[model samples]
Target: MSTATVNPAGGTSPAPAADACCTPSQGEAILNAGQAEALALRFKALGDPNRLRILSIVSASESAETCVCDLPEPLGLKQPTVSHHLKILVEAGILHREKRGVWAYYSVVPGALESLGASLAAKP
Candidate 1:
């Protein structure tokens, strides 16, 4: 009752059993749809070069926060454009926005980067 096939070389080999060939690998847990969508939004926010630069500038500021006013000159971008990038970062939960007087200050959200990295880490 062997399930074997003849090869072109005139050799008879046992074909792979259906169950063995179709078995799924036991891998680590994967992200759910909601988690995937949220992480995708965060990654999408960081995908732009200008947005990444804005994050670096804000995170590297001496006061641990940066005013939107100061970002335009350093990035060589217009004020409105800088503000737009900041808005996306904030919406992605990667940055925090605070209003002081008429100015908006931006800072990296605590542990946000670490959380994003951990989501992609392999479980042991």
Candidate 2:
């Protein structure tokens, strides 16, 4: 019988089977083409350090919303540059934009981050 070997490091480890290593079972894809494309865009939007900082600021707001006007000061970026990053995030569906009079407020989309985490989970 085939069996796993113990490493003596206090954790159970499964045996590595060469035959099973590269074999793919007949199963549905982890992500469909469209879902992959959408997830890719969201990840791409997050690829930039500036965009990640912008998301962090909006996420930490007291009211769960922050005005675009308030972003530039903390980031030390100009309004136009901040707006450009916000636009990518909004297009990626990671944030919600609400225009209030002259300023635009941004908030994290409900369960957006959780959904993204779930998508990349190790187990379905």
Candidate 3:
């Protein structure tokens, strides 16, 4: 995908495609070699089904976050196992963590998700 830098301050530079609209709010920061690796690592973490389910369940709650005890029984996994998935998500920058005593909370990182979407939508 082609990368075009967008200023985070204000205003949007045109994307490579002339007809493209919905310019990103944060000016495009084209992913370089290193940035691409970082992004790929994030996607790799998401390739797991368990991780995806945890994220979905957490996202479905009234709060944008989830606690260790909140997962459903259908996952059929222990808390430590579930927390392992959460750790990968957290490392991937796709999740935000809140520690309340021994209860660790997790939430989606919208900017990372949006950036991933934008990169995919960009020209190849």
Candidate 4:
């Protein structure tokens, strides 16, 4: 993949291509290195089946949030395993975690998933 920097003053400029042979005239990437890295991390976190299911469960909650203790049964995983998945999702900014007494409740971050989807869409 080729990388480029967006000129803050106005526009974009190509930096260097990781592989010139595969590089196209597409010009610059809409995302910078840091942005690409962060996005990649989010995608990586979602690459797991368990993480996808965990996200689905939390998002499907009618109250828009679910307690950590509530995840195990539907997920068919132990509480500790579910918690581990939750931790990764939280770190990826895909979910928000709140502690109330001993239970941790999680909710999807407002526009995080939407933003990720938009990022993947072709831009005109």
Candidate 5:
């Protein structure tokens, strides 16, 4: 598995430092078009207010994880809609999902949630 590390936020993310010769070794290169697009897509998914709220809630959850059934009451959305958003988050790599019998669980993917912060710090 590719390890994604949750970095503490610095004043400026690495994206702004694309040409930075002083780039930290922790920063990974977006060496190809595929990587750039993938990172952009992840950011786009998080661009939504609802998804952002969901991420915040899930991130702050006691277990750092939650199930679909547990989300609606706090989010004030129907389960189906919540599930749809969850799917988008999962696809975008911001959230991790797993099946436990009939229900599905979601959790933030460590560094995955913070990729945008890194991208923003880059030169691009």
Candidate 6:
């Protein structure tokens, strides 16, 4: 059954029932809460320019990794500031950190960026 409503011309038209508006559409894929939270953390880490720059520098390094001590000069940031960004990236699972004697080195996690891109391109 439908309800009647006045149109712009002042004639009555049958309007859809209220329940019809609440029906869930089929075949739509949606992220669950946990997935959304995880993605948000990763995206949030990438939100900062410094963090993105850190990813770029590390990815372009000869060994596909970079030493913590080597970041400050190129980034124009202090050691502590660069370190802070690196920590966020590591926590977000976008980068991996390895401690080698006196310095920590960072590299991008395998397939992490690809997974993120795939999530956006996913179909129902």
Question: Which candidate has the highest lDDT of all?
Answer: 2
Number of the predicted model whose TM-score against the real structure is largest: 6
For TM-score, candidate 2 versus 5, the one ahead is 2
- Looking at model 1, the pairs that clash are none
Model 2 stretches astray by more than 4 angstroms? 1-32, 62-64, 122-124
Question: Which residue pairs show backbone clashes in model 2?
Answer: none
Report lDDT (Cα) of residue 87, candidate 4. Answer: 88
lDDT by residue for model 4 (1-124), tens: 4444333564344654554344344846567888779778999999999899988888898475799888899788998899898889989998998998988889999999988899789441
lDDT value, candidate 4, whole model:
0.81
Whole-model Cα lDDT of every candidate shown, in order: 0.80, 0.81, 0.76, 0.81, 0.76, 0.81
Better of 4 and 5 by lDDT: 4
Q: Each model's TM-score? A: 0.72, 0.71, 0.66, 0.71, 0.66, 0.74
Q: Tell me each candidate's RMSD, in Å, in order.
A: 7.4, 8.7, 11.4, 8.5, 14.0, 6.8
Candidate 5 per-residue lDDT, tens place, 1-124, comes to 2223324676433343444445456545546788778777887888888888888888888475688888899888998899889989989888899888987878888887456687678654
Candidate 3 C-alpha lDDT tens digits along 1-71: 45445545654554645444554446455667987787789889879898888877877873656887876
Better of 2 and 5 by lDDT: 2
How well is each residue in 15-113 modelled by candidate 1, as lDDT tens digits? 545543442333547767887887789989989999989888888873767998898998999998988898899999999988999888888999998
Query: lDDT ranking from best to worst?
Result: 2, 4, 6, 1, 5, 3
* Residue 41 alpha-carbon offset, candidate 4, angstroms: 0.2
TM value for model 4 = 0.71
lDDT of 4 at 35: 76
- Kindly indicate the candidate among 1 and 3 with the higher TM-score: 1
Q: Model 2, residue 97: what's the lDDT?
A: 93
